[model samples]
Target chain A: MTTNKTVRLAQRPKGPVKPEDFDIREEDLADPGEGEIRVRNAFVSLDPAMRGWMNEGKSYVPPVGIGDVMRGFAAGQVEASRHPGFKEGDTVTGLLGVQNYAISDGKGVSLADTSLAPLQTWVGGLGMPGLTAYFGLLKVAEAKEGDTVVVSAASGAVGQVVGQIANIIGCRSVGIAGGPEKCDFIKSEFGFDAAVDYKAGNLFGDLKTACPDGIDVDFENVGGDIFDTVLAQMNPFGRIAVCGLISMYNATELPPGPKNLRNVLVMRLRMQGFIVFDFIKHNQEAMTALGGWYKDGKLKFKEDIRDGGVEAFPAVLSELYTGGNFGKLILKL
Target chain B: MTTNKTVRLAQRPKGPVKPEDFDIREEDLADPGEGEIRVRNAFVSLDPAMRGWMNEGKSYVPPVGIGDVMRGFAAGQVEASRHPGFKEGDTVTGLLGVQNYAISDGKGVSLADTSLAPLQTWVGGLGMPGLTAYFGLLKVAEAKEGDTVVVSAASGAVGQVVGQIANIIGCRSVGIAGGPEKCDFIKSEFGFDAAVDYKAGNLFGDLKTACPDGIDVDFENVGGDIFDTVLAQMNPFGRIAVCGLISMYNATELPPGPKNLRNVLVMRLRMQGFIVFDFIKHNQEAMTALGGWYKDGKLKFKEDIRDGGVEAFPAVLSELYTGGNFGKLILKL
Candidate 1:
């Protein structure tokens, strides 16, 4: 019998998640069922959306119940398999929770290719974050060639992919990041047209200069001031794909909505909020297109990996809100 | 040459429009040019949108310049014409401003049909407000048969029309009005499935009770509390057509946006803001459809015609915000 180290939700979070909100425990793992596969998670994804799942309320997905293993996405090698399609040693990715091993009935489990990309990249560029940017920019925002695309949290997992994809498709990409380091990286490494450092206190002015022709597509991740600023610079018939509102995920009370909402009427803008799961049926199509871009060297990504096993789950997740993580955050068990 | 009594913008309103903000002046009317027609204004349309045009900012249309005639829509008779498309005694409707007489070069002037509907009905049911409800509900909201449609300001021009049209197309319509009388009118006269009086102090509870199946389409006219409340009851993949924000038009300072905007993502709601002019090319189509509904007795309308002529424009316009007017508020010139 294998002893699995797992992090479980101890209680619902009040605001910023405290370490006490989660509990680390060791449990015996049962053998795979007749048609199930056992996965030993190599890398668990730490995302801003995790903060939302910890709260007690309605959302795109249900809240993680107390005493349950913290829900998350992970990429790993299949350790044992009773399923005909998946075999031992096959690389797979699925919602494996924050644990050492996960047993699945093969639902939502996909075979991953490490030959084309690294293990971490499967949870980074070719994972949920990558697909979010792919479908959000191309399908949701309907971004076309020569369009000016502006994205917030440009150094984060999804925003970075959004900026790079915009560039690959012949659009001018402008990124808004928290620090000078992220801003510089987005411009130099990611090949963004312009990068605005929001921490510089000149976000509005900097954004104005970066997008002179006005933002045609706004890929919103961090809502609040960033959303309000970008909204004012949106062109007529602009499209805003509200992917995430990380800034408000941990708030005890929601802040007022964007004051410039009237701009939607005046500019005839279409603003929609979407979840990646809504486009789950089209995952293969998105992965194929994004995988081609990755092979062509037209896409670049960075992973912020933390090594502390299951006990580090709560602490590492905090890095998303604190701006401590520079890239796609992952946990190496 | 004839003398025209016109209401001009004396100064921009700081909040709720003051009578002092307008200046009524007598001016000599210009003769019709080679291709111009002279219209003797019979009924001037007073709308919530006119309040927005008085503010000094960017909007769907430019602000009414100081000392310029207050912009409005009117249905009147063409007394003289040098234009081939129009002649004497022809009823017409256009942006004729707040004046007794208007001269146009035959642009945007549409011949009004008083044969199928009354003259004032042209401004009430076949005018901009009627077309606004038609296109906003069908085209923008994409309301289909069996969809639960909720419209704010249910007793007002656009709102009433929206409810009636939703019913005509086999959709269940719910209306939100201010008083018990208005609420009763919407249910009894307009054939709404349910009506909630926002002034009843149980707005949230009443709305939840009324919309048991959840709102599929929200035709928003009045913003603020009404908008925020309806937003919460929206079902998954709901559509919100932001036709007007009358609640915010007269606000001295813009109020905080709806806090539950995150529902947009969780519910996968598509919220779009649109101006009627965006569908100008389809006016004939919209009018023809709405007119057919009216002739079949399937659509009924009531006009709150204020007999105060052009000088009473400012006072009558205030009735919209105060809920003093019961139906389509129009100034009988």
Candidate 2:
């Protein structure tokens, strides 16, 4: 019998997430039943979307119920299995909850190939974040060659992938990140064409300078003033893919939206919002392309892996919203 | 030589237009020379877009420059023609300025068939407003059968035609207007299935009641809070064809955008802006369909023809923003 250290939701967050909002403890693991498998989670992926899930209302997905195991995407190894598809010691990844051990019936679970990357990389670059960037930039924004592609939260997991993909497709990739350090990182490390430091102010002027031909596709992650600035600089018939509004995710009261939506009317822009789940049918195509790019060295990922196991889940998760984490944040179980 | 009473843009207004902004006086008009044709204007179209045209900035088209004849759409008779395409005394409609007489080379001129409809109707239902509604509802919105289509400024020219067209295509039509009289007018006169009076203070509740199955297509004419409320009630994969933003046109300062734009991400809505001119190439298709519907009694047009000719251009145009006009506002010469 194995003791599983797990984190569960205690209460819905009001503004920013607090450590007291989660109840982290140990639980006795049960053996797998018919058509079931047990996974010993190696890492728990901490995402910006987790903050939205902790809120008490309808969203892309249902809110995490209080006192229930916190839902998360995790990479692990199948320890024991009664399922025909999986044998012992098969590396896998899926929505396996925030815990050291996860019980699964093999629904969303996929084999994580160590030869392509590491086990932890499955829940990082090649995971949900990578797929989100793939579908959002290519499918939603319709980024093509000779286009100017701008993405907010550029140093983060999804944004980095979006910029790289834009470069691969021959588009000029401009990233908007906080501070000079992260801005420098995206340009030097991820090969982004240009990086604009949002914290430095002069967003509109800086963005205008970055995109001389004017923005064609905007992968909006951070909303509010940043979005408004980008809106004003959009060329005619531009596409805005509303991937995430990380700036408003933890707000106690609803904040005002982009003040420059008039640009939408004037510029004849198309603004569409989408989630990764919306493209579930095309996940395999995204995975193949992402894996190919990663292997060819055209793509690289920066995983900000934190320590202290499942007990540190709440503390590490808070870093994502505050710009404390520099990359794809993950908690080492 | 004919004496032409014309309204020229004397100066740009700060907010809601003032009559002093125009230099309304008589000018000596010359006869047709070479390929030029002279038109004696009868009716000048008064539209919400006139306010935007008065502003000094980049838009879908150039701003009405100071000292230039106020750009307007008008229907009139060709007094003389040197162009082979048009004959003398031919009823025509085009971008003839807000004047008693206009000289054109017959570039955009379209012949008005009095046998199908009246001459004034050429600048009303069969003109810009009618084509705007037709293209915005059908092409831009892609409104199909079983769609719950909602149009703001329902009693106005474009809104009335949008509702009627939605009905013709087997969709549920909902209209949002200011007062009870206009609300009653849209339902009774334009055949809108439901009418929500936005002046009734409970816009969200009333709109919810009006659109029972959630809005599929939002033909947004009025922006500001009205557009915000409509945005919140949109269904997943909903299409919002932003035909106009009448509420913000006369605003001295820009208002905050929709507070419920989060619904755009949650519901995965696609909001796109478009002008009637964007579909200029498809004008014939729209005209044929609209003319066919009008002849079949499926479409009805109400032209609010205000007397006082070119001098009334500023006052009659003001009525459009203030919601004083009942239908397609037309200034008679």
Candidate 3:
């Protein structure tokens, strides 16, 4: 008999989630069912989007039901497999929950290789965030050379990739991040043309300097006044890919508007919001392109990994909302 | 020599234009020169777009300079002609200004059949506003059948035509107007599938009932909260054509945002701001189709004409911003 530690949703938090929202308990492991694989969680990705899953509403993905395991996609080593395709010792990735072990029936499960990149990179840079940056910027935003692309949350998992990809496409990439260090990271390491320190008192000034020619494409990840400032500076026919609204995720009320939204008309701009799951058809193309970028050394991948086992889930999850991590917030057990 | 009453810009007002900002005076008309025609102005068009022309900045047309004739388009009779294309007694249209008489070089002027639709109709339904509504909604929005369309200022010139054209294309049309009467006009006169009374309050509730399936196309003329409401109700892949921002035109301060704009991504919606002048390439196609619709009685036209001469220009211009008139607001000079 084997025991596995799993985290359960104790209670749904009204706003920003706390440790009380989760319950860690040990469960007796049962035999794997047909076409099922048992995996010990290695790295669990912490995303701002997790805030939405805790809410009960209609969205791109299903809500995390009360008393169910806290839903999260994780990458790990397979402990046991009764599946025909996957075998023991094979590394895999899937929605493994906040558990040390998971049973997935072939669907939504994927194989991972550290040879391509680091194992954690499979969950961050080259995973959902990278794919999101690739498809959303190229396919949805339709970014082009000589175009000025502005991105928010510039040092985060998705934003870092988005700015780098914009640079790769011969665009003038401008990133808006929390502090000077993150801004420096995008400009120096990611090869972004410019970076704006949004935390500085002079946001409008920094934005103006960072985006001298005006923004042609804005990959919005942080919503609030940042969106408003970007609204005013957009050139004609600018495209904004609505990626995430991280700033307002914990709020119990509707966020204040960007006060200058009507600028969308005078500038002849296209501001569209999107979720990457909608581009399921482009998954292959995304992986191929991103994988190539990773190989060519044109892209920079960074991760802040915390290792403390399953009991660390609550503390780790909150760090994402607080923006405690410099890059992709991931946990390795 | 024929004497004519002319209204010229006396001074540029700081905010809401005042009557003192205009100067009405008599001007002596010169005889027609070669390639120039003398026109007796009959109807002068009053438009919200004129406010944009008052400010010294980049715009669709140059600002009306001080001491110059208050720049405006009008329908008039060609009293004397030296141009080969125009003849005496012919009804002509041009940038005839706010004067009762003018001399034209016959350059950039459109000839109209006054019998088909009155002079005011040429300004409203058959002229700029009409052409604006036709091109903005059809060419810019790319409105298609089965798509749900919502129009702000539903009983006004552009909104009325946009809603009816949506209906003509076999799409569901929902109108947002100021009152019950205008809402009724949108349905009874313009054949909009449904009408929302914005002044009645509960705009979101009314919008939900009117657009049960959600909005695919939004012909935006008014900005502010109304824009926010429509954005919340837009469906995935929706398109928004920004024609004007009447609601924000008279705003002395910054216009507050329509927050929830991030929904543009959640729904994969496209919110675009455009000026009809950008769609010059599609002019021939637009004219041919709209002309056919008008002649076949498939489309309806409306005009709000104030029976006032050049002296009434100041008062009539205020009516547009105040939402005091339905359809296109024009003045008979």
Candidate 4:
């Protein structure tokens, strides 16, 4: 008999996530039932959106219920399969939960081609984060050639992909990251047009310097002061794609909105909020474009894969909010 | 020799318009030049945007310069003309300043068809305010059949027309006003489906009760707390046309933005700011529709024409920021 190790939600978080909010347990593993497939999850993806999913109340998606396996996206090889579509030894990825083993009926499961990249890559750039950037920048913001695109949280998974895609589409991509190190990495490694180090305490001026002609498209990930500064610099008829507000995710109380929101009126700007799940119908088109870019050397992804198995889930997940993770955060079971 | 009584901007207003801020004086009026036409103005329009124009910063339009004729829109007959486009007794309306007489070269001038409505109505509903409501509701917000459209400052010039137009287009129109009298007037006089009295001290609950299926479109005229409540009640894929922020215009300092702005993302809402000038190309189409509705008795306009000349401009204009006017506040010269 084998044992499956899993992390379950114990309670709702108050502010920042704490380890006591989750329960790590081991249970007896069962074989695949009728039309079911068993995946031994190799890598579980960590996202800022996970923090929102743990809260109580209505959100883009339902909250992670207490005592249930924590909701997450994972990539792994199938150990057993009773379904005809997926067979043993097949690599797949989906919302398979934060567990050593996941059972699925193949509803949202997608086959991962390992010849293109590793399992961690499948759960990183080529996965939800990559697709988020693809749809948000192209479809929502409608960033065009010769446009100046700005993105916040530039070193994170989705932000990095967004900047790269903007450059590929002939836009001047300016990234906003926390420290000098991450800022330098985005410009040097990711080939971004410019990087504004937000930790330098000159956000408004630095952003103005980076975007001389004013911002045409903004893929806003971080909310609060960062968003306010971007709002002030937006050109007439600019588009803002509100993909995430990670800065407000863990707030115990609701914070005041951007003071420069008046810019939305005076500048005739269009601001729309969107989730990657909202664009599920266009997944195939997005994946084809993203995968093509990845294969042609136009795209690259960095993974911060950690050890200590599923037991390190809480600690590794908390690193994302603290800016401790340098790239696409993932846990190797 | 005729005399022209004009109101010139003495200095930039700090919080609200004061009588001392304007230098109302009479000067010897000159005859029409080679291409200029002199208009004997009868009615001047008052708008919330005028307050923004009084500041010393950038806005949709340049600030009204100190010692210059205070910028305004007015309707009158051409008393004398040397321009080919104009003849004597021709009724017109344009950005003709706040004075008893105006000189124009026929640029941006729109001929008023008094046969359709009165001169006050031209500046009130058939002029900028009407076009604003037309483009803001249909073009900017895209309010269609079955949409629950909400507008703030319900009894004001643009807001009344917005509600009436929504009803004409087969939408459920809801208006937000301050007092009970204004709220009841919107529903009974302007034919709004419902009215939410913001001064009733139960804005959130009242708005929820009025919008049973959730708000689908919001024509935001008043920003601040009223905007925050409507934002919270918005349904998925809702559209918000930010036509005006009357509540914030007279604010002495920058106020915190809507606390519930996060709803824009969670509900996948689209909030766009627009000015009537941005849609000038579509003016003919909008006017044809609005005029047809007005002629068919399906559209109604309420003008609070104050019996005051250009000298009363400062006091009458102050009434707008305080919500003292019951309807479209226009000054009769």
TM-scores, each model vs. reference: 0.81, 0.81, 0.78, 0.81
TM-score per model (chain B): 0.89, 0.88, 0.85, 0.88
Q: Candidate 2 — which residues are off by over 4 angstroms? A: A1-44, A64-70, A74-119, A305-326, A330-333, B1-44, B65-70, B74-119, B306-325, B331-333
Candidate 4 Cα misplacement greater than 4 A, ranges: A1-44, A54-56, A64-71, A74-120, A305-325, A331-333, B1-43, B65-70, B75-119, B306-325, B331-333
DockQ score for candidate 4:
0.65
lDDT of 2 at B7: 98
TM-score-sorted candidate list, best first: 2, 4, 1, 3
Sliding window of 10 residues with minimal summed lDDT for model 4 chain B? B280-289
Tens-place lDDT per residue, model 4, B1-333, is 679999999999878889999999999988889999999999999987888788898788889999999988899999999999889999988889999999998887777777777778778888788999999999989999999999998888889999999999999999999899989988998899999999999999999999999999999998999999999999999999999887776688878998888888899999999998898767657766877788788889877899879989999999988878866789999
Candidate 2 lDDT over residue span A57-153, tens digit each? 7677889999989999999999999999888999988889999999899887777777777877788998889989999999998999999999999
Give the per-residue Cα lDDT of candidate 1 at B60: 78
Each model's total of backbone clashes:
0, 0, 4, 0
Best by DockQ: 4
Estimate, for each residue in B233-312, the C-alpha lDDT of model 3 and write its tens digit: 88877888888787876688877777666676667777777876566455446655766677778778777888879998
True contacts kept of 1: 0.82
Model 4, A234: alpha-carbon shift in Å? 2.8
lDDT string for model 4 (A211-247, tens) is: 9999999999989999989998999999999998877
The CAPRI classification for model 4 reads as medium
Candidate 2 interface RMSD (Å): 0.8
